[model samples]
Target: MTQSPAIPLPPPAERRRLREAQSLTQAQVAERVGVGRDTVRAWEAGRTTPRGRKAQTYASLLAAASATAHEVTLRQADPTAPLTPLTPAQAFDALYAFCAPALVRQAYLLTGRRELARESVERAFQLAWHRWPEVAVDPDPAGWVRATVYECALSPWHRFRARHRHPEAPPADPADRALLAVLLRLPPPYRRTLLLYDGVGLGLPETAAETEASTPATANRLLHAREAVAARLPDLADPALLSRRLAEVAAHERLRAARPPVVRAGSERRARNWTHAAIAFTVALIGATTFTLHTAPTQYNPPVAPGATVQGVPPRAAPGALSRAELDLRTKLQRAATNGPERLTPDAR
Candidate 1:
C-alpha cells in the first residue's frame, strides 16, 4: 500500500483560529485528534506543536473545516449572527462535522478498514439526519450516533463482503503487530468491549448499551479481553498500560465521515405515509381474522330419515290405556266387600 502524503502544518494561530471559527472546544478537538485536551491547549498556546501523524490529522481537520460554517455552531462562532435557533438540517450538519472523525475512528477499530468505517459512520449519520428531531432533543446525540455506528459497523450485511475484503495488514513493527493480531483474533463481543472501552474511550454503561450487553456482561467481556491480550503479551501485563497501548494502536488511522445528504420534507412525508399505510393494513388484517373466527357459522347434525335407526340414543316408548270393563269389575268388587260385612251383622239380629 502507498503511504499517505504528509500534510503541511498550519501556523499555531491559524490552527486556533480555524478551530474557534468552527466553535470547537479544545477537548472536542483533542478527542477527534486522539490526544489530551492539554495537548490541544499547548498547541494553541505555542508551547508545543503536534508531531508525527497527530500533526497531520490536526492540520487536515482545520483545513477542511475552514471552508464551511457549521450550522449548529454558527451562533457560537458569531454571537451576534442571530443564528442560535437552528433548523434540524443545520443542527445535524454541525454534529456530523464535529463527531464524524471520532465516530469513524471507532468504526475503523471495529471493522479494521477505513472505507468500511466511513461507510458505517455515514449510514449512522444519515439515520440520525432522518430522525434529527429526536436526535437533537436527546441528552447525548453523539452517543446515540455512536451507538448507531456500532450497529452499522457490526451489521450482518458486512458479513459476506468482509470475507472478500483484504484482511488487516500487520504493521512493520513486529511486536506491535503481534499484539494486534492477538487482539484481532479475540471474539467479536470481547474485541468490541475492548475497543469501545479502551479504544473509543466510552464508559462502561455507554459501551454496554452500544454493544447491547448488560453492564456486568460488558465488564466480564472487558476483563476477558484484557486477560487474553495479557496472556499473549506478558511483558505489558499491567491492565491500564495495556489498555492505553491498544487504544493508541486502534486509533492510529481515521477517516472523516462525510455529511450525508438531507431528506426533503416531501420525501419524509411520503415515507411516513407509507409507514402509516402499512400499520393500517396490518391492523385491518388482524381485525378481519378476529371477525372471521368470532362470527363463523356452526354446522348442525343432519335429520334422520323416516325409518332410519337412530344412533347413540334409544327411541321413546308407546303410550298405553286401561279397558272400561276392567274398571267396572274393580268397582263392583269393592262394593261387594263392603256389603258382606252388613249381611253378617243381620244373621246375628
Candidate 2:
C-alpha cells in the first residue's frame, strides 16, 4: 500500500493582504510569483496552499505589495493630496502652489540674493495663474512656471535695474557666489529646463508641457542645461555627490511648501449641492419648454428637402447653401435666441 501524496497548502492571509494592498489582481500576483492563475486564485481564496520555494516567492511579492501600498497611502494623505497623481486641473493647482517657492530658490541660487529672487518668483506665479487655463493644459506646468519665473527675472525692467544700479548691500556669501557662477554658465532656456526637470524631478512630458514646447525641445533644453552646468560644476556630474549637495541645499532652504489640508468633507458637500442644483435646473427648464411648446401655436409646415417645392413656396436652402448675408443674419438671430438681448451687438439691433 502507498501513502497519500502531501497536498499543497494555500497562501496565508498575510499573502492575500499584501496582494490587496498593492492593488494587484490575482493574475498579476500569479505572474509575479511564477504560479498559475488558478494557483494564485486558490491561494487567495484559501482553497490550497503554496509550498517550498513557491511560498518564498509569495512572501517576497507580499512584501513588495505592502511597501507599494504604504507609499500610495502616504501620497494620498499629503496636504498636496490632489497633486500626486495629477489630472490637468490638479496640475494647474500644484503649479500655482509650488512655482513661487521653487522659483525663489532657483533665483536665489542664481542671483545670490533672497529678496530679488522672492519678488521674481512671486511675480511669475501671479502671471502663470492669470494664464492657468492655457498654461495648465500644457504637459509641464512646473517647467512653464520655471521658465516664466526666469523670464520675469531677466525682463527688460530687471535688466535695466541690474545694469544701472550699484550694489547697495554686501557681497553674497561665498557658497552663493559659487552656485551663481554655476547657474550663470547655463543659457536661459536650458537652465530653466534643467532646474525644473532635474532639480525638481519633473518628467519629460511634464517639462515640455510647462515650457510650452515639444518634448524634444524640452529634452534638448535639459540636455544642454546639464552639459552647461556640468562643464562649470563638474562635481555635480557625479550622481552621489549631486544628491548629497541637493540634500544639503534642501535641508538648509526647505523650499517646497508643507502639505495643505485636504478639502474632503466640504468638497463632497459642494459636489452634492451642485449635482442637485443641476438636476433641478434641468427639470425646470425642460418643464418650461414643454409648457411653452404645448401652449404655443403649432405650425404644420411639412419637412421639405432643399430645392424641392413645398406648398406654394420653394424649399428652404440647405444649411451650407445659404448666402453669407443670410448666414450672418441667422447667426445673429441664434445669438439673440440663446443669449438674450444683452448679448446682441448694436449692429444686430
Task: Evaluate residue 57 in candidate 2 and report its C-alpha lDDT on the 0 to 100 scale.
Answer: 59
TM-score result, candidate 2: 0.38
TM-score of 1: 0.53
Model 2's C-alpha root-mean-square deviation from the true structure amounts to 25.0
lDDT of 2 by residue, 222-276 (tens): 7777666568778777633443453244335534432212222333455678799
Q: Where is model 2 more than 4 Å wrong at Cα?
A: 1-99, 128-147, 162-176, 243-349
lDDT of 1 by residue, 1-349 (tens): 1111111334567778888878799999999999999999888776665544565477557745654445435656777776555566656665665567666766766666677877778777767767777988876676677788878887767767855366756555676577778876888789888876665555688678778889999999998988888788886678556655654554455466564344234336656888999999999999999999899868877888678776988656456664688679889999988878544345564
C-alpha TM-scores of all predictions: 0.53, 0.38
Worst lDDT run of 10 residues, candidate 2, spans: 1-10
Full-model lDDT for every candidate: 0.68, 0.57
Clashing pairs in 2: 9-48, 9-49, 9-50, 10-48, 10-49, 139-209, 140-206, 140-209, 140-210, 144-210
Worst 10 residues of 1 by lDDT: 1-10
